[model samples]
Target chain A: MSITPEERLNVAMTINGRRYRAGVEARKTLADFIREDAQLPGTKLGCEHGVCGSCTVLLDDLPARSCLTLAVQAEGRQIRTVESLADGQELNTLQRAFREQHGLQCGFCTAGFLMTATALLEENPAPTREDIVETVSGSLCRCTGYETIVAAIEQAAADGAEGNDDAKDGAQ
Target chain B: MKPPKFSYVAPTTLDDALKHLASDPDAKVLSGGQSLMPLLAMRLAAPSILVDLQHVPNLSDIEDRGDHIRIGARVTHREIERSALLADRLPILSAAASHIAHPQIRSRGTFGGSTAHADPSGEWPTILLALSATMQAVGPHGNRTIEADDFFVGPFTSTLRDDEILTHVSIPTTRTAWSFQEAAVKKGDYGLALIAATGTPRGGVLVDPRVTVGAAVGSVTRLVAVERILTDEPLTDELAEEAAVAAAESVKPISDIHGSSDYRRKLVASLVRRAVVELKNGA
Candidate 1:
């Protein structure tokens, strides 16, 4: 189990609108890549076993568990982390709703929920309340009873429908 | 937990994949990585050479053959869940896919890997068993197909050889009404027990009714006696209840932190009845 030329490889990806290149061990996960190598730490790791969807990120606009994804595998994919949510000082509708509606308490699982909800709303503009519940069920939150989170996502979906989503895609 | 260091080889062709598999004794096929990566992170199973099949061509397509749906090995659970054709021909695929550890896991978990992993508690094994799906595999030797009933060997194991790769799963499209049900404590947790049933009504009598139960034992088990009881008989709620009871008595469940052996048996029986009721309603 020693390293060979194949074991150490270089990979590059456009993460949060910026391209990054790194040569490292093939065993690194996308979660650690974005956190350590690329220096974006918004993607949290609650349970690295893919049980907890805390390391969720948008892989080509689909919510995917970064911890389960190898860094080398993401060489050519478009990745968006929670850091891509807000442009600068301004927050996305989802983040605004989460704050306004008290959707998070400990704030550990907020990024995952936000990222997952982002893709859910993007795919289906007007998802039913049941759809919201099903989408949020992917990310685990211990503090809130999930009612507030559901309401927050609902508010974001409603906001997105009002022609504000385009201007707010980049937040700032 | 970070995965241990290993050699990564991404092969774009099946021939190269087969060569790598045959050359390296420690090479492991990396499909969706929804299951393998977790094991790698936990340091439970370490393979020195990782043969990533993500770049393998034509392994993620879903082909709708005239009589059967041929699903590629790299087809993700999310793709299956979103397939409109699968919803009609085999609603069980989408129904079961939706419950597989949420959207993130489903987005990356492959249909073939889950079938190859052969976790007794998984949704695919039981559904495939009930559907009598064909497991297509390619190895250094040659290509072959394994019936779903004969594919799964034990928990987290299958009849696939070390160098063989599960290429596709061919599920013969059924005109029958099917239902899949599972009881889990949480939304993403593995179910305590699961039941998949398919029944076709022919002249007011059901024909070829099959029931497969999982998460109660080492591998998927078909309720043959229950299928025999339902075949050629006019289906009724009372008859479904009797079949459920027979299914309950059929499985030898083991206790786990999820549920007790008794609880799993009762759960499977109740799920069997509910699945049958749902199937009856669907028809």
Candidate 2:
């Protein structure tokens, strides 16, 4: 019923359509588990105290702070990181829109923005400017001002980012 | 920063979880981890064991009991925001839920967890106090219900015993018009001052007016002086101004980095006026 910090518990989860298993300490955060054990550094860790949204990932199809979530807590849950946003090397509609609209300059907070926007667009295929702003306001971005990021999301929604049904069916 | 060393236990049963909590004096119950994780990461709290309640059954349902709604402790903020029943019955909650952080935190943060965390700046405690909700807690011995007024004692402190787990909260459905107003630096940031007001408009008079202020003091406080001024009084601009002034004078808010005590008092007054006006306009 309990796993001490000294002991490692075998935790398995589906990440970006692939199942990954690792023996993680009870205190290991999902952000570290994904970046180190799963080797997907796309989910960035800015403020580990959950202030910054750089470490956001889709947990069970909803955006959650990976930094605040423990690996053991994510057991059996489906996770989608920023790495899952593209098809092979080509950028997805949302990513392409971000590039076109100059949504990122430093790109540290891009993953969290993309993940949070993905969930929003999927849930509400047509999100208003206010909706996009309301949802992404939690994720802080220092570069590109936030107008461009909001514009990018607006563009993605306009460009039919919701048309990608594959993303709707878990990670592809 | 990484969390300090600790043992983790995710018990599927409430009895087992209670047993684990009873056995360890230093154990902390892990609800949604939105608040606890921050404390852990900051090394503010170093519990020996974490009793995670994720796997527990019957802790995530939102049951409509006709006259009242019973929301389980593990009901996430996203769920509360999206629930059709809540939108129809408790629209104030759905509206307030959007103001609790961003989409990411709401997707994982539980209503019970937020209430149990009892942050002075938290929206749930303020809303619950306004609604006169009852919180259910289950311990090793049995279950007991604590009124929202008595549940919160101080900032980040609750009446919940270490061995007791908050099971659910029951809110009586009402036709009272409500308004939730708060001012934060950003959309998702913690509010500098928040107000939740509920009043039944009968004829031209506002009855049973409840004005609860949060995030500006040590605890979520209902401004009884403001409430007394508005109760059974005609909802008017002058009355709203009086209530606002009373609200501003009644509280000795803490001066924090987010806002000054004077600024927060002003915010409280403005927010109270705004909420009263909104309720007067039948918002």
Candidate 3:
């Protein structure tokens, strides 16, 4: 039996200090809500089965798979994405490290990894090699063997702790 | 993939939720949507009514009762991972939540949803089965408790009657001895084979262990012989090893895309050995 299309519900959420409200379909996913409705396409969709971390984003300072989350569920919540990390033309230290260390290839999984890493560093400042591995364990980068990604996060952690301004530019 | 059009209803009351579910047999209650979303996208599940339970108050709180902790089904995995009481009393649940699908999924996935989903391979059933936890479901009629053993009937299915909503999970506080172990091919996927064992007080072990082989086995089976062996016996490395193999003897694992049934059976034995050994070592 088919269900008649109900009137789209209104969902208002705050993403990166900006508030967005939309009339979304009942079945719309948070990932689609962000990309299609909010005009933020940086959150990549992969697998769509919740197995891949390519749809990762931050909900209330913690990383989550936006693809599996409902748009209505995110109402009145704080959602963050990779697009919010940069300030004007300046890049976040994690992005800089990813560049200098060559953390990404093809760039599909980069956004998810960046969001995951950002949450990791917040919860843990000086994480060890094992911690780094555990923090990013959910994300799968079919390229680079993830060694460079670890290095980038490590380097970024070091730079941020020391307040290294040049590292902010990501020149290493 | 866009889900099929459906009428959405976010009921604030438990009665309201039941009314919605009873109104339509096909209505699916959306909790965190971690499992439901994918089912919809794949066109495997097409429900005419969507009952959103996010706004239901008291459904998300974790109550640290003196003897037993009452965890709302909506309590997220992240909540479990961060709960100190859960770590102290129900460490196995916390440990299981920590291993589920990574931080992102953990942030939104619910304890009740996982249990109700009754995934043979998912961490919740194994942990609940090991702990012998009690699940309380509220429906249009009222509330009823279901034991872990009786809760799961098959893969992706539960014994919950139609129109019933699982409200909370109550776990014991007396038994402190617990051990858990899981092996997965890659990060965030279902376990290749996972085992959880808990030691009850009075030295009588509730060796109600669950052996779930994901992707390899189409379904999970309880190791009755192994449980009998462990029930009266003291947990030991040698005993555990024997029990592990014995548990394998009762299992009829099937080969799949993840691993062969033979390989999975072997892995189950090895993993169970490791988990029981840790319990003997008081880990």
Candidate 4:
């Protein structure tokens, strides 16, 4: 006889400053939970294997590979995906810089790169180019050769110094 | 595709975990799942039960007790990389660890999991072997300390019993001087070949050389001939190169797609030369 785990686990957590409760399976991946259950498709799933960082997300303010994490494992913890990157209509500095620098092409890897860069900048606002490269090393971008993406981050840093745009209040 | 369907259990305590493991004959303890998930997805391994250890909170901290460093089994590689304690106390481990798969893999993969998985090309076995670290295995029989030499038996294999869960790895802090060099084709893949040595240099002589060659054979092995040569003779440019040559000759490598046996042997010799040069240059 096969025994299944009790299916009703209260997954109460905050995301983008809004609280949510989800009935999660013990086996459901955090990526599936966020996309299918929470309806946030910004966190793309590619190479469900951990190698591709497309499913990168912030778990309690730290960058994590969400595909490998179990949804039940994240109960009562704060989760953030790419959808939380900007205000309702305004683009965050990184997003705006990405546009200005042509950091994206097809845009499949943008969300992962953005989330990772956001954490990197928050931790070290004055990071050098080497730091940016190392921080984004986990994420792969098949398009643009990563030059514009890196330039976009530098552009964002430069823009932040010039105070050309209002920075978002906190991480999404 | 999702991993093959299997039963999962997250135990609340270590004792409960042990009980569950002892009860199930085909149970696998899930650590970071960086290695295990790939195996499950490929259908290479299909254990009846996966005993998840995430709920057991104690296995996530790094403890420094001055004499040795006790790393909890579940501590992620990122934690060790960012820790000042590891950098200051055991920098060789950090160096080897920094080369592990990548930042995201390092962020999720646990130190104990790598060692327990016992991949010859992976960083943990070579690093711990260099440090002469100890493995603490917990099973229904209770905890027991196994020295690094005795822990790893062969490729993708360990001394761990079916019911045992690796709890911690204790690395002695005293006389912990070491150096590491790894060569790989990409930024984040298993090294093509690697050489790691730990010990002190005294009076122009390399003392207690714990030399081990990785990513060469199906499993890692200590190069005793090189260790003996370094111990008795002073390490010079000529002698170091000869030692590297000897180390390469010592391993019996097989021809695989990653590289040919002849190629790996040459690469191993070159890496050893670089590693010894690093040592001679005060690495």
Best candidate according to DockQ: 2
lDDT of 1 by residue, B159-254 (tens): 999999999999987647788898889777887888888866778776788888888877788889778877887767998798889888887887
* Runs in model 2 lying further than 4 Å from the true structure: A167-172
TM-score of chain B of each: 0.97, 0.98, 0.93, 0.96
What would the per-residue lDDT of candidate 2 be over residues B1-283, giving only the tens digit for each residue? 8999999999989999998899889999998899999999999999999999999999999999988899999999999999998999889999999899988999999999999999999999999999889999998879999998899888888999989999999998774689999899988889999999997678877778788999999899899999999888888899889999999999888897788999999999999999989988983
lDDT of 2 at A51: 91
Clashes of each: 0, 0, 0, 0
What is candidate 3's lDDT per residue for A42-69, written digit by digit as tens?
9999887777689898887778888888
Off by over 4 Å in 3: A1-6, A161-172, B201-220
Prediction 4 global C-alpha lDDT: 0.79
Docking class of 3: medium
DockQ, all models: 0.56, 0.89, 0.49, 0.38
Worst 10 residues of 3 chain B by lDDT: B207-216
Clashing pairs in 4: none
lDDT, residue B155, candidate 4: 91
Candidate 4, residues B1-283: lDDT per residue as tens digits? 5666566777889988898788879888888888887676567787777788888768888889788899999998888888898899888877777788866677778998999999989888887887788999888878899998998889988898889999999988754546688888876777888788876667777667788877887877788887877784666799879878888878777578899999988888887787777777773
